[model samples]
Target: MAGPSSFAARRKVKGVQLTIMVVGQSGTGRTTFVNTLCEQPLIQHQQPVAPEEAHLESGIRINPVQVELEEDGVRVSLTVVDTPGFGDQIDNEFTFNEIMGYLERQYDDILAEESRIKRNPRFRDNRVHALLYFITPTGHALRELDIELMRRLAPRVNVIPVIGKADSLTPSELHDFKRRVMEDIEYYSIPIYNFPYDAEEDDEDTIQENSELRALMPFAIVGSEEEVEVNGQPVRARRYPWGIVEVDNPQHSDFQRLRTALLQTHLHDVKEITHDFLYETFRSEKLSRSLVGDSMGAGYGAGQDASVNPEDLATQSVRIKEEQLKREEDKLRELELRTQRELAERRQELLAKEELLRSLEARLADAQHSNSSTPLPPSQPQSPIPQQGQPHPVLTPHGGAPTNGLQ
Candidate 1:
């Protein structure tokens, strides 16, 4: 029923919509990386804070910025959700909850919309397709914070770990760091989004490309906004006293490969996985929880309705119970760990206090001993006061006074 011009206009207005959420601590080049990837300033650099206000907790802020971009002659609608001050606080548990809640809320929105009798024509799907977690370039294994965050959120989003400000480390250091990070991820069973391809089913080029990208897991990112002349051509690079680090140089960093994979090659795959797996899983769990709750409230016998299969309902109920127990166990484990850390810190503090007390006692005892050991100089006999007209005696260098003034 639509005319050709109308169809063309609708196609022009509706391009591929992709939402990416970036999470990292401040000073990890998150903003610069987003800007560099977009080839324009999408996120403004955080303003410098005053020293007095530096310790204030700003809490986590979720900001979504929409931008239209063209990649490989295809119009793309991109939404970047930036989580500022995610890991800035001393306790990041709340921050984790905030981020997790945001992701699940998107799913909840979709669920509510699906349940509606009539669909809203202008509703937008803002579910985040991918999450880029910028790991701090510590040149060491992944921190507990990193492991915990990715572990908890991987079930909900496509988490891609990347090392930010990676130019700070040497090539060897970077390689070692990446190896250690991947090892930690494996050890902790963190489900990060690794570029996946089937060796038998996928084409050779696809397999090779994916394998290469997977090997470069936790991509090394060196982003810069400034341009410098390289071979008589201006390139985006961070100038240093020793050399220049180019953003697009494959040898310098993995920015270009990551950009291509994220925007060009694996974009559809990421979205498909999000909808097919993550959202579906969430929806199943949500519905199961609701059904289980209703069944329990009404009595177990009431669950054997004609419309629903008893076996499926029982299976869902058992699965939901297991999930609840697993979540509780996780919470208990986290609490125990936190308590142990606090106890250890308190023990250290007590030991330090005892040491200080002993030191002070020793110093006090030494002072008392010194004062008692050496008696004050014996009182000197007062010399007779000379009369107003009498001459004063001149004391010799020795202990005896001069017998006469002339002497």
Candidate 2:
């Protein structure tokens, strides 16, 4: 049995590419995990987010990073995408609505772009290669919202369910977690993995932990029967060189494994795609040849002859560009006018505040001066009597010796 790092060294493959996505509720360490994989601190939010701040890119935004990993003559291309935690304790509804809206807009945008490409002669067929979904483990089973989201996205993409934060669970607890997760995902037929199962630890510890998981999750499966244990309640998990592993963070260990696996698996598994699929695949070199030589002969040449005219395409493109430029100009003019009006209003507000402050200060000063100038009435002097005291009385200004108590 090999450790996670050693498995990385042993795995041999070439030129594999994969796109991975990390998702969860707000503040579930998604960003931190991505930064670890990228080997750099990416982005983090300091406060609870509203819908407006969801797209702000400072905190609640999607971050994409790419890296290449080579081990034992095997090369893999990994693209890790970090998305904002959809629902937060403080702003659950707002975040959910915003994210849902964004995804809807995103799908629409993709479809629109695909339509544009299909309409053009130059690009007829292109699409994204693979899609990986990441989620942190929770005590409860997959939520209704999770299932809904997965159902919506599964057909359109190759959904890989990654059980992130496996380190948080103990051996037995982890077993239960993986068991429940697989059972829930059975209906969707989504491939699931208990990833990041403490990759930094020794092989013995990880294998032991994995075995416990296998025992509890008997019906759950991996890529192959040989790679996983379905019987004997194997309390010690067998090592798979290609299975996902835990690293210090998602971007480094599990992230690397995902990248390496995709680069290998996609190159091997993907063969032919339909015209509809091509519109999304982005027309990479590996897939370009697969588009031609169809039975119906509905290809680049046929589409070009039937629906496209080169001069018209060029004219339409130029017209679109001109319209885009005009829109940009209009937006800039509107922004400038708004800015000037805001500045004028701010200046007036500031002047009013200053005048109010000055008036208050003057009133305060006047009150203080009047208080200081006003004099208090003098008190009456007391007479010193020799009979009442031991000392003799002193004389006063107006016969005070006789009148002031000389008796």
Q: Among these predicted structures, which one has the highest lDDT?
A: 1
Candidate 2 runs further than 4 Å off: 1-17, 42-60, 66-78, 89-131, 188-259, 263-407
Measured by TM-score, how close is model 2 to the native structure? 0.39
RMSD of 2: 23.4
Per-residue lDDT of 220-300 in model 1, one digit per residue for the tens?
999998899999999999999999999999999999999998888999999999999999888876777578668667554
lDDT of 2 at 128: 32
Error of 2 at 153 (Å): 1.5
Q: Name the candidate that leads on TM-score.
A: 1
- Candidate 2 local lDDT, residue 197: 43
Cα shift from native, residue 274, model 1 (Å): 0.1
What are the per-model numbers of colliding residue pairs? 0, 15
